[model samples]
Target chain A: MRYELYYWPEIPGRGEFIRLALEAGGADYIDVGNRSEEQGWGIAAIETFLGGEVTDFPPFAPPFLKAGELVISHVANILQYLGPRLGLWPGDEANRLWAHGLQLTIADFTAEAHDLHHPLGPGLYYEDQQEEAARRARQFISERLPKFLGYFERVLIDNPAGERHLVGETLTTVDLSLFHVVEGLRYALPNAMAEAEQEAPRVIALHDRVRDIPRIAEYLASDRRQPFSEEGLFRHYPELDSDG
Target chain B: MRYELYYWPEIPGRGEFIRLALEAGGADYIDVGNRSEEQGWGIAAIETFLGGEVTDFPPFAPPFLKAGELVISHVANILQYLGPRLGLWPGDEANRLWAHGLQLTIADFTAEAHDLHHPLGPGLYYEDQQEEAARRARQFISERLPKFLGYFERVLIDNPAGERHLVGETLTTVDLSLFHVVEGLRYALPNAMAEAEQEAPRVIALHDRVRDIPRIAEYLASDRRQPFSEEGLFRHYPELDSDG
Candidate 1:
């Protein structure tokens, strides 16, 4: 079945996690919001489903993937559903669960990355909360960025199967998500990422390796790969980057 | 099999979600962090597991549930595993996935609640970030509190099975988690919750119903139900509360 991916046409945000999985897995899907309302695939479809009582399982937000009768939201949950279907997840249940756990942790990391720019709340403009964002960015660059990246490094180092992959010998959805996390950080805090990479070489390497995967490499170069901007989860603000 | 749940002893936090599921399902479990070192179930065990490479799937934080060979982490993932074993989750795959997506949404809500007080970073004490927390608490109480609670109200309103439960006419983990969310909100923001509850009558009613579930009612009164404190996920700060 062709998947209908519903998300804001603009920001990569959480949808990027699912987009990367779909692209890397070579799955057939349509970016619904990118299409016209006449085609019956638009933001209104998402807004309608969200605002009206259309489905028994309603998504709290966008970046939801619809497969046949099932509509799965939440990056980790969506990936968990698509992982095995696309042959991206391991066969074993425990490792699959581990992979899901890793993705959930990545979700937490992603939210924190967003908060680096929107420290007050999403409703307020970055300018309105620049003072708060400045202080929050410091803790993020100095403490959180390393803690999250280092934890991934340690996971890579401790993987019983191997360090090449987060879950097993083969690539899983978590690897792709972590790859995006690396890209997001580098985009948002290049100077800090340069320093953080020293401690998280494995994490960096995994990010590098994921970039070279044929399908992923092609996807990265293609128009499908959205550029990081101020509107996305990871935004490049020179003031927020740390030299230390 | 008896499960050993590893989480911070002081706070109900994320662990409470799993605890409610286990308690309501009548499953046997040991709160590892709350136990004495002499019992081989202490905070040291959790620290060792996180710091050292013991399991292939080592948890980044506590509130991981160890069920025989499986070491499940992340509140949603841990509960997904226990849901079936404890009979707290729905039998069907679709309903189970819905419960999971709902739980993930709850996870996001819970993080926003925690961030209201720790907007700067978890590394800094709440007192150090008092000014930033003040700004965030305003947004959280005014905007996020209603948005999240309203979303749950809609979910309950839309549930085809019945509004009594979050999923197909049975109390799933999401229901218990939502119960805790409402309880936490009420304890943390009594005035705001009272105001928000008016708009989310179904959500409030579901919370009330989950509380009165025989096993849950007993657990609430028992010492097993940790008291809400400043150190917990839902902390009571008079200044943070809004009369509106």
Candidate 2:
């Protein structure tokens, strides 16, 4: 069965995590929000689910997946549900849970990355909270960034299966999500990541490997892939980035 | 099999969410972090997993549950695993996924609540970022708090099962977690929750219902339950709270 992914059309936000998994898993799915008015699907399609019509299981936010009768929201939840179905999971309950934990960590890291540019919450624009955002970015670059990247680097190094993958001997959605996170960090905070990546060589290698995955490579080069922008989660405002 | 839960011993932070589920589910478990040194457990027990001995499946942070050989991290993941086993879940695939989705939203809400005092991230203290905390608290109380509470309130009212539970006809882990969120809000932002609760009567009623659950009532009165305090997630800082 084909899946319907509902997210904001303009940016490669959290939805991109699921998109990478869908592409890497080689599943048949449509990015609903990206479709034009002629194709009969757009932001309105996403709003319909959030517009109270589907009251029983209303998604609180975008980046929800509609698979048959299932509407899964939250990036980690969607990835966990899609992982096994798309053959992106390790196929064991234990490893699946482990991968989900890593995905959750990545989610937390991504939230922090987003916060670096909007430290006062999304209710206000980044311009309104530039001072606070700059301070947050400094602390984030000096502390949180290293802590999370180092943790993933350790996870990769300590993987009993080997250092190549995060969970098992094969690829899982966690790897895909991590790859996006690394790309996001590099794109959003080039100077900081250039320094940070030095200590996380293994994570960088895994990111490179994920990029080389034929399906992900094609999707990255295709029109379906949206570019990162200030409107998305990992925004690059040079003022909120540092190399310390 | 008895489950072993590992988290920070003092505060009823994220770990309390998992604790409530274990108690409500009537599962036999050990709160490893809360145990005494004489009992051969404490913070060190939690550190063991983080200390790198468990190479194959290391948890990024805690409130991790060890059930037999499976180690589940993240409050939602752990509850989702235990919900079916302990009969706290709705016992259907769709409703279970819905419940998990709600739990994930609660997780996001909880993080925001924590951030009200730590808007600069946990690298600094509330005293260090009191001004930013005040700004964040205003946004949280005026905006984020109501958005989340209203969402849950709608979820409760929209439940096809009835206006009782967040997921289905019976109490699920989502209800338990939501109850804690309400309690935390009321404790941390009494002035704000008093006004916000007006718009979320159904959610408030659900919290009351959770409080009356026989198992949960007994647990609340027992020493096993910790009190909300300044050191925990829901710190009662009057300066950072407002009715509007």
Candidate 3:
């Protein structure tokens, strides 16, 4: 079945995570919000779902995947649904649950990453909360960043299947998500990430492997892949970043 | 089967969501962290899982569930696992996925509520970040809180099965989680929540309905259910709350 992904047009944001999985898994899908309104798909299409005109189970926000009658929202939830269907996750009960837990952990890390720029609240502009953002970014880089990365590093090291994959012995959606987190960090906190990567060589290797996958490589080089920008989750503000 | 829950011994934090489900479902479970060290449980037992001595899938934080050899982390993941096993969720696939989405939304709301008292970073004390916390709390009570509450209010109104449930016709884990959010908000932001409850009558009613569920009513009065405290997710600081 062809899937429909609804998210903001301009920014990659959380939608990128869903995009990576779809692209790597070679699933047939449409990026609804990115299409022009002239063709009947764009922000208007996304707004329709949120407007309660579509179905009773309205999404809290975008990055929702519409598969026939099912509209799945939340990054982890959408990915968990798409993973097994798209062949991005193993079909075993235990492995699927474990991969989902890891994906949820990534979701937590993504929220924290977004908070580095909007510590006062998402309602406030980054400029209005620059002081608090800087403070949060400092702690995030020094403490939380290393803690999260270190946890993943350990997961990779202890994987009974070896460090090649995060779950079972195959390329699951969890590995794809880890790759995105590392890439987002490298873009958002290059200095700190450069130093932090020393402890997570296996994670970096996993990121590289995902990138080199033919479909993922082609997708990254194509126009569908949006560039990292200030408008998205992982914003790079030189002032808020440090070598620490 | 006896389920094991591992979370911080104190505070009805994220773990409370899981606790409400277990208690409401009348599932046999052990509150591992709350047990004494002499009983071979407590923080030490929780730490053993985190210390990588238990399983390869180490949870990033607490409130993880250990069922047999499988360990599940993240509040939503754990509930999604327990919901069906304990008969708290419908057996159908569509309703289960929908319930999981709603649970994830509650998790997001919980994170934002926690940020009200610790806007700068979770590592910093509320005393140290009071200024930023105050700023965030203002926006939270005014914008974020209403948006979330109103969204759930709409969901309750638009539910095809009627306003009695969030997912299908019967009570599910999502209903229990919504009860906790409303209860926590009332305890943490009484003045604001008292006024805001006006807009979301259905959500408030749903909260009341869940609280009156026979098993839940008993759990609420039992010592097993911990009291909401300042150390938990929804901390009540008079300076950081308002009736907006």
Candidate 4:
């Protein structure tokens, strides 16, 4: 089955999370928005996907996945649907729920990271709210980053099987997402995340292991892995980072 | 089976969404955090409930529902789990997914509403970022209010069963959440919502109908229905409500 991902083209943004799993699993999928006009898919094609007569399951926003008749939205929900299909989640119901709980935490962190640059509103330019962004970035760098990372670190340490994965002993989409989140944070808050990593060695180690996976390694080496930039969630604002 | 809900005592906040389904279905449940100290349960009880070391399924935050061995967090996830058990969702898988999609949209709107007041960070006081709050509220009141309400209106109108319910002819949890979202927008953006409602008659009608449900009527009349206030997600800052 072919999976079509619809999201804004230029930035890795939320779409990258979905892209990471699909690429890692070597799934058959197309990045509809990222393709050029010559390939018969672009921003216009993405808009048409959303515009075509709306269904009851219509996505509130992009970063949605369309597989056959099924259209799933919300990053965590989409991943939950894709996890088992791509062999990225354990088959057990309990373990799936545990993985889902972790995914929800990752989603929460992603939203907070986005707010650092656009605290005022997404519709407003980042420059318009740099002052407010600076304030929010401070709280995120100092309090939230440690608290959230510490919570995940404790979860990993508390895993009965070991610190190999977030849920079961096997790799799940939750682990891949954590890897991306840590990567984004490093780019956005290099100094702060560098210090916090000492408190979350398990999380950092899991991230490294995910990168070592052959499929993920190939994807990262290929052009599909979009580079992080100022336009994305984890933008580097010099004022927001500190060694402390 | 009895369900125990753990959330902060006072506000109708996120917990209220869960409360609506339990109340409407006449399910046996306890709002554990709101129980009086004399009754041996209060905020401390809620804290203990949260802090108790548990297995991997533990909720990261409050407003979680404990039913038998399952303890679910994320308001939308909790509602999705309850919707089936409480007869609040269509039994068919497709309809269930559609209902869940609607609930997720409500959750998104709720997050946007909360951000209007705390544009900087939830940890900071609203007074510390009033300027940014004013700017954020403007976008929410003007742009988001119409878009979300308009989407719900379209969903209801497009429902194959009818416009009476969000997903089907039956009253799902999404309907209750939609009612609350409308109530929130009205409280936060009286002028903008008043005007936008002109284009979203179906959404308005659903909100009115949810209020008239017999169990909902009793819940609203009872003290369990907390009034909207400055402390809650929907705040009536006169500066934030405007013709824009």
Candidate 5:
């Protein structure tokens, strides 16, 4: 089935998470908002999707996926729905729930990362909130990063199968999500992530292993893998980074 | 099965949403953290649940419900799991997904409400972030509040079943959550919510109707239903509330 991904066109933003899964699975999908304006897919299309009158399943925000008649939103929820369908998660209900729990944690980390730059509010520009951002960045880099990373590291080490994957032995959407968090932290808090790597070696190793996955490798090498920028979640403000 | 909910005692906080459902359903559940300190239950117990070294299955944070072997975290996920078990959701898978989508949105709004006071970072004191909080509050009151409320209002209106409930004719966890958001917003952003209500009549009606549900009425009247406080998500900061 052909999947339609609705998100802001210019920025990879949250939509990239969905894109990674689709690309990794080689699933037939269309980035609806990214299509050419002449093809009736653009900013207006996204706005209409957001404000349209005929929404049976209205999404609070974007990074929503429409498959057949099912329109799923919320990144973690969307991933949960897509995981089994795309062979990105375990088939068991318990395992799926565990994976979802892990995904929610990743989402928490992602939200914190975003807040470091936009602590004042997403509706305002980062520059306007830089002072608050700086303060938030300190807490994020010092306290939250290590806490979250350490938890994941322990999860990996404590895994009955091994420390290779987040949930199950094989790769899952949680692994992809964990990799994204690591990559985001590296981009946004290079020094803190680098210093904390020793404590979270298993999580780091998982990141490396996920990068080696064939489809993921190809996707990362391709143009579709948008480079992290100021507009995205992991924006680099020099003050946010730590030496140790 | 007796359910054990692990969350901080005192404030209604995030745990109240779960409490509302359990109370409404007349389910046998224990507020583990609210129990006496000497009984290995309280804030310490909550911490143990959060920071424990359980490898079998771990909850990243509290407001998690432990039922049998299943320990569910993420308020929305917990509600989703409980919604079915408690018969608070439609049995159909697609409808369940939709209901979950609504819960997730409420979770999002709840997070935003928390951020209004702690906009700089969760680690820092509100006083340290007061300036930024003011700015963030303005955006939340003006933009996010209405956007979320409007979306839910639209969803209720668009529901093929009817507008009496969020999902269908019957009350679901989503309806309870929407009621919580409306109550929280009115407490937190009274003027703003009042102004926005003109455009979101369906959501207002749903909130009012949920309060009138027999079980819900009893729960609200009972001491167990903690009053909204400055310590909770919906803090009544006058600066944040605007008629505009």
Candidate 6:
């Protein structure tokens, strides 16, 4: 069954998390919002979903997935729904719930990362809040980002199953998500991230290992993988980067 | 089975959501962090769990629920786990997922509410970032808060079952959560919430209804219902509140 993934056409945004899982698991899915209207997919479809013009379960925003009759939204929610179906999560209630909890924490981490560039709110431009952005970024890099990444590092090291994965000692959706978070941080705050990863070697190693997975490697090299830019969650504003 | 809730003792925090569900469902549970060390439950218990010294599936933060054997964190994750067992959600796969999705979005809304006051991360005191907090609060009151609350408002209005609930017509956990959001917003941003609710009468009505439910009403009236204070997720600062 082909799943329909809807999100903003440009900028990886939160959609990339769901995309990575789909890509790594080799699921039959279409990035609907990224496709043209001629292909019967576009932002209009997403608008309809959000506008409550389509299904009864209206998504509050994009990054929603349409699986047959079900419309699931919220990055963590969507990933949780897709994780088991795509064979990207261990097929067990205990492990699936654990992976989902990790995904939710990752979602929290990403929102904080996004706030580094937009400390005021998404309504305001980065330029409008550059001073606030800089201060926020300083606190984020020095405290928040490192704390979060380090937490995941500890999770990896302390995993009872093994240090290989966050849950069940196998590749799960959470591992894929950690890869995206680490990747985004590296792009957005290169100096600070380089230092942060030194303290979170296990997390960094997981990032490298996820990137090397055959399907994920191919997807990264392929044009389908959207590049990080100022418009996305992790923006490389040199001013926002605290030199490690 | 009795449940154990681990969270910061002084503040309601995210654990209140779990507490509300347990209260409404009349589940036998212990607020572990609030218990004394003599009782074998305290902040130390939480620290042990989070340190990954006891549980293999370590929680990134508190507000996790400990059932028979499952230790679940993330407010949404814990709620999803209890929602089924406590009969707080639809039992079927599709509706259960829909409920979980709404819960995750509520988690996002709660995070935004928290950030309105602590935009620079929670490490620093609010005064250290009061200026940024003011700016963030202004943006949040004008743009983010209403947008999120309004989205739920629309969800209440557009529910296929009826305007009485967020998921299926019965009192799902999401409906209770919506009530809490409305309650928190009213306490935090009285003027803004009053104005916001005008455009969301149905949501306001739902909040009122949930508050009046026999179980919830008792819970709210009892000492167990912690009053909103500056220490909690929704803090009332006259300056931060807008006259919207």
TM-scores for candidates 1 onward, in order? 0.98, 0.98, 0.98, 0.95, 0.95, 0.97
> Measured against the native two-chain assembly using Cα atoms, what DockQ does each of the candidate structures obtain, in the order listed?
0.80, 0.84, 0.84, 0.59, 0.72, 0.77
Q: What lDDT tens digits, residue by residue, belong to model 2 across residues A56-115?
A: 699999899999988888999998889988888887888888898898999999999999
Off by over 4 Å in 1: none
Evaluated on CA atoms against the true complex, candidate 6 attains a DockQ of: 0.77
Candidate chain B TM-scores, in order = 0.97, 0.97, 0.98, 0.95, 0.95, 0.96
How do the residues A1-244 of candidate 6 rate in per-residue lDDT, one tens digit apiece?
A: 8999998987788999999999988999999878998767897777878888878888777788899998887888888878777888888787777888898899889989999888788889999999988888889987888789889988888787888888887798899998999989889999988888889888877888999999999999998888899989999999888755
**Candidate 4 ranges beyond 4 A from true positions:** A54-56, B37-40
Which predicted model would earn the best TM-score? 3
Clashing pairs in 6: none
Candidate 6 global lDDT: 0.86
What tens-digit string does per-residue lDDT give for candidate 4 at B1-244? 8998888888888898999999988899989888986786778766665564654555667778778877677788888778888889888866766676667778878988899989888888888878888889888767887888888887877788999998878988999988988888788778878898999998889999999999999999999888888888788888877865
RMSD of each: 1.2, 1.2, 1.1, 1.9, 1.8, 1.4
> What are the per-residue Cα lDDT tens digits for candidate 1 across B1-244?
9999999886788899989999999989899888998878788889878875577777878779888988888999999888988878899878878889999999989998888888887889889988888889889888989999888988887888878888888888999999999999898889888888899999988888888999999999998878889998888888888865
Taking the tens digit of each residue's C-alpha lDDT, what string does model 3 give over B54-102? 7887888898999998899989999998988888897777777788889
| Residue A210 miss distance in model 4 (angstroms) | 1.1
How accurate locally, in lDDT, is each candidate? 0.88, 0.90, 0.90, 0.84, 0.83, 0.86
In model 4, state the lDDT of residue A89: 88
Give lDDT tens digits, candidate 5, residues B110-131. Answer: 9999999999777877777788
Model 3 lDDT tens row, A123-158:
989999998999999999989999999999898898
- iRMSD (Å) of candidate 2? 0.9
Model 2: CA > 4 A from native? none
Candidate 3: where are CA atoms >4 Å away? none
lDDT for each residue of candidate 5 in A80-195, tens digit (9 for 90 to 100): 88888888998777777778888888888889989888987789898787877888888887888888999998888767778898787888888988888888888888888888
User: Candidate 1: DockQ?
Assistant: 0.80
